[model samples]
Target: MEFCDECGSMMKAGEGEDHWVCDSCGYEKGRDPEAEEAMETTQGQEVSEIIDTSDVEDKGLPTTTVHCPECGNDRAYWYMQQIRSADESETRFFVCTECEHKWREDDH
Candidate 1:
């Protein structure tokens, strides 16, 4: 792509189409009747920005005095989950160690 006024580097096309070679100082030069067009890249524009926070700080998950049909609270914060069948039995789930209130006990 033409650029080697005796070693400024970057030419390369010679073997006589009228000469050009200069891959760093083999300096030939003389082939430019227009022919240099290859450099293209395009793809930029994406932004989704989303933020939601309920701020939880519970870090304690195994307690159980159970009984908090919504704030009746007598301790609670358990877990069991297998959600049915593996020969059924494991779905206890609760959570109210003072009203963080969440429940789930069904197996009938």
Candidate 2:
């Protein structure tokens, strides 16, 4: 992806495939063949298998006794993530061990 030099915004493809144009500032720059090659090389690479963490029995995550609303399971794995502003508390996430149900608890 190309960025505009004048407005510092992401540039879009120009009329042809050889250049990129910035819609915000009307700036244009020649597409770099090396950058394009690198992007293609990365994009063409084989993608690894995606593992569903919730279904996995062991994820090295801490366990809690929180109630699962979906399956009525008492055991679950819990983790915290900051889903709000920096000053706010981190949200607590839980995945049921039995039914693989995911839920979150926020400190709003």
Candidate 3:
């Protein structure tokens, strides 16, 4: 009888199937052919779509009067983005254009 690597539980052989199921932890093992094919296709597409960022524009949305904290330069650009949190609250990051420094800002 095979054993589970995670919880040290006994693993049962799946009848007429390629998977091995863990009786104690309910963990499933073995690859699904359809799911594997889908993942491969997604990875191939992502590899093809990867672009060089050096030649691309920053394209960050515009904001008002973002000053650099280090150099005190007021001619910096700003961008607003949604950051995920543990409590599911959104946080914003303000990036300075001149110095490329990032700072967290509260929603106003």
Candidate 4:
């Protein structure tokens, strides 16, 4: 997760994974062994229980009585996302249960 000092962009591993290089500004930095050990990610360090939901349709999402313009379905699964600024309201997304149509509603 090294960042480029020149352009403030994320850097990637260079040739042979010996150094980090910024693609945007062509900046390179040698990898430190001590820093690499400290920066080791904790991903996959522990195994968590995985629930299989292959038989579920909506993946346990809540449903609402939203109108689907594509298939005229009255029932749809809804979720909210912060697509706009933090001060503004979150955008409401709807997926029709019958026809799987997707749509979004914003507080304009």
State the lDDT of candidate 4 residue by residue for 1-108, as single tens digits: 799989999999999999999999999998887877877566462333222333336388788997888999899887776655779897787777887877776422
lDDT of 1 at 21: 81
Q: Of the candidates shown, which would achieve the greatest lDDT relative to the real structure?
A: 2
Residues 14-80, model 1: lDDT tens digits = 7756887877768775665654334444443212221111122255467868678876878876667
Error of 3 at 90 (Å): 1.9
Clashing pairs in 1: none
Worst 10 residues of 1 by lDDT: 45-54
Off by over 4 Å in 4: 1-58, 106-108
Give the Cα RMSD of candidate 2. Answer: 6.8
Considering TM-score, where higher is better, how would the candidates rank from best to worst? 2, 4, 3, 1
Assess each prediction's global lDDT (C-alpha) against the native. Answer: 0.63, 0.77, 0.59, 0.76
* Model 2 lDDT tens row, 1-108: 777889999999988778999999899989888867776445332234223565456668888898888999999888776655779897788888888887776422
The candidate that achieves the highest TM-score relative to the unseen native structure = 2
What are the per-residue Cα lDDT tens digits for candidate 3 across 11-103? Answer: 777866677789888887874667645653346754664333231226644655766677776754444433444477655555555665656
Better of 2 and 4 by lDDT: 2
Q: Which segments of model 2 are wrong by more than 4 Å?
A: 40-64, 67-73, 82-108
Model 3, residue 55: displacement in angstroms? 7.7
TM-scores for all predictions: 0.21, 0.47, 0.35, 0.45
